[model samples]
Target: MNRTELRFALHLIGFLDSVEGFEDGMVKLRDRRWLVWHPDVMAALFRHDRDLRHPPSRTLSPLLGNRSVLWLDGEEHAKYRRTLAPMLRGTRYQALIDEMVERSIAELPSGPVGLAEWTRRLTLRITGRILFGVDDEELLAAFTRWLDRRLGSRVRTLAHRYLTPGTTRFDPELDRMLLHRAETAEPPALAAFLPPEDLRDQVVSLLFAGHETTASATAWTVYWIDRTPGLAQDLLGDADLLEATIRESLRLSPPATLAGNRMSADGMVITPSIYLAHRRAATYDHPHTFDPTRSPPPPGAFFPFGGGVRHCLGKDLALTEIRTIVTALLRHRRIHLNTQRSCTPQLRGAAMAPPPSLAMVATCRR
Candidate 1:
């Protein structure tokens, strides 16, 4: 790898003491955790996923709640998936997504704006309406405030990571407030679809999981389109190219850098690296370049939503939201990167997003 590529890879992987065995398909970190990124190994792991179990997450439980599907294993995890899968899959929410995208596009802010923040708010609003069945601005704003105060600060985030266990991160006051708002919402919101017994935890998990990742993906797609000459115009004219562009963007910079950590009954711990898996030179021609025109990737090679039975539940919904937002923005406004700002990859909680300094200017097309 070239110097530039090596630097990008490091940012994507975050901190690791050694990559000495990476070329051999798996590498052991300083913590003795193994990350496997090779396509064959990853595929095999997923294929035999029945033998693997999700490792409970201490850091996330307090934030996402103890019962959150993120840390659940065995039948508990499958039950959560079963309850939520039907609602997320298929064309059930496509119209709702397209409507939200158009509304967000129609109200585009004037002048240069932070693209990451812009997309975050947009997705937050959409997620709130669809998931909670309410568009209470006060509630959404309060939720953001709570999360910002806790996870937004670099100092607090570090302290939460190293200073204490994950369960310590939960805020009871905020949790109660969020749950009350969700419970009071009228029927038809996706929140109603969740079982009431687990409503609070499920609401917290869905909202937290749904918004930021989609927003990050949207921001990254816009960045790629802005940097590639005439790409926006090409996307406007062809639907397939727009899809390809979104796929390419996800492949290049998936919002979530890694899949859930898994452990075998035999005590073998393995983590799948989506970032590394997507960038393998063997699987992608010119892996570092953001080329949307490349031919389709092989089946097991491009599992951005992850592989196996535990693949992301929001796959179709996320793609639809991204396609709608990108297509709508390109159709209505001309967007350009604010080149004065850095566009480096930075970690935002669990998601990898364009740096906060990354700005873009969107003006209406005459």
Candidate 2:
């Protein structure tokens, strides 16, 4: 395995071996130190530890900015998250469901396509319209091109340098496009609260987080549903089953496999392994199986979205989007896996993405 995969495997092995107790270890990988923790320790750290803070990764800080909510801590983080919370509530997102469904239906391919790429494009479009109030195809295309390079790049340092806020400027035209949208837009609920200087970074961060995670989750949802015979038909008639399917897919393949690493002001590091936590046998019966009919896992027990104060602000909106996309796709088309190989999750940057080669055929439902 390559260095990144090796690090992930070590952490996973530690988690699997310590399913009954807390697991903590320090590892030096690529010249940086990481303190990884399983759920037992994570529960305490997430709840009572006020000092644990998300230290910006060398790669992410330049892209997300110092002021973005993901990098903020304590009062600043809470304040920023609170401002953005209203836009993600169920009532607000419910109003957008029809539009989301319509868009997915229009964009879905009628023949074999890479499911991951298709979902990423659809989610990016939905995020662009909802968050920025800009539906210009060319602008969205540019943003997708820029974002894909950053996310998919293998040259870590170069990608970090390219995205770092002041080291090198973003494309002038794209900057103007985003700034113009921010100046003229409404909704996304948090836009009004962002200062002019911080607006671009915050918007970029939101767009990245908003589309990337949902794309991974939605892609996995499609894979699992297609793998299970009769699953689509059952979901078509049952709302609970559909919701359960989404949850099960998330449980097995959370997009954000690892929560952001948090470090105390002193010297301690704490990172929560969301992937390991989801697989805890105590919390999930047949932890690895994708069984949608099983009872829902309990709160805190299932956290595809990290927990406590830093919980994802877009959690509700993400769920709504995933449900809408999956429902619309299944309802409008008969999907079948086109590849002979079984699909599995692989790390793509910070998210757990389905195999890049995963292909599926979608036939329109008559």
Candidate 3:
């Protein structure tokens, strides 16, 4: 079969996603892991993925290597996930969607502005309100600045080499707590969850990865849906169709372009390529095309949040946030791409971001 055409067809059918699919793809990049069976192998990869600590594997998805659990495998991964479980349940996250997100988006400045940058703001606000219970505007801006510095600089790459295990670095938590506690009182402060150094990293990862990544996915989805007039009509015409559109969009531009990485210390056939498998299952059609009106595949076909035990911890939160924001946008405002729009990819550490210049505008309902 002609793989290229097949890739194109999948996009036409909405089977493969472009933005994030490349992140998980094996055909192009080197040193990556993709979950094929998803419900099976992706789970297996995450379950045994901790081998990174031993060496050879070093770090999987080095772009997101700082996440604490990325180095843990098997029972260890489970233990950490268990502790984090209560905080990220689907239902609890869904609750935050309704009460907090709408008001925040409603407050944005209107008229031909770049929604790409704003999408990041929208993700951060929901995460701040729901998880940290703090929304100090200035502190949030500071953390965003620090995060941008860390991700968009070469010093971090140097730290990966020079700052091994014992070397100290400025704590990532100091800013968020200051931002939250300094501003609000209702849920009180998070004087408790701040200590365990490693837990702090998780919070940082949650903010950076949680909101930024989801916002990228959400922004692209909104843009493409608007580009495809028929698909936008489909979503506006049917609620069930909304979920399908989101699923297809996620398949196209995944937040993390790459999936998990694995190494085998034992006799295990540890094939380090989750992104490839993700691209494989969704193979066919212009894999890069952004077509929302596609057919749904069987479970585990598109491995974005990953597969198995090592799946993303904040997936439910991200989904709730995206759905809430998208659904809300669809409900009130009509979004249109400005004809003179321009955006360039900015490198932020391991993440890829559209330049800060990326801009769009939406109209408020009458």
Best by lDDT: 1
lDDT on C-alpha atoms for all candidate structures:
0.75, 0.72, 0.56
- What would the per-residue lDDT of candidate 2 be over residues 1-366, giving only the tens digit for each residue? 456535444444343334423333223333334534355566776786456777775456665666777888888777777777775664575656668667667766667788888888888877777777757778778887766666564354344544353553356787778777867776543457887787888887888888889989999998998888889988896888888899899988888877777777775666666776777776678877888877765544677888767788888888888888888888788898775545655555667788777887888888
**Model 1, stretches more than 4 Å misplaced?**
1-21, 30-32, 153-155, 188-197, 340-342
The all-Cα superposition gives candidate 1 an RMSD in Å to the true structure of 4.1
Ranking by TM-score: 1, 2, 3
lDDT of 1 by residue, 58-149 (tens): 44566777677777777878887887887665377777778878887778778778898888888888778776666777877877876666
Residue 264 local lDDT, model 2: 74
Count of clashes, each model: 1, 0, 36
Lowest summed lDDT across 10 adjacent residues in model 3 is found at: 8-17
Q: Candidate order by lDDT, highest to lowest?
A: 1, 2, 3
- Off-target runs (Cα >4 Å) in candidate 3 are 1-67, 152-195, 266-282, 298-301, 339-355
Instruction: Answer with 2 or 3, whichever has the higher lDDT.
Output: 2
As a TM-score, model 3 comes out at 0.72
Which lDDT value does model 2 have at 226? 85
CA lDDT, candidate 1, residue 176: 78
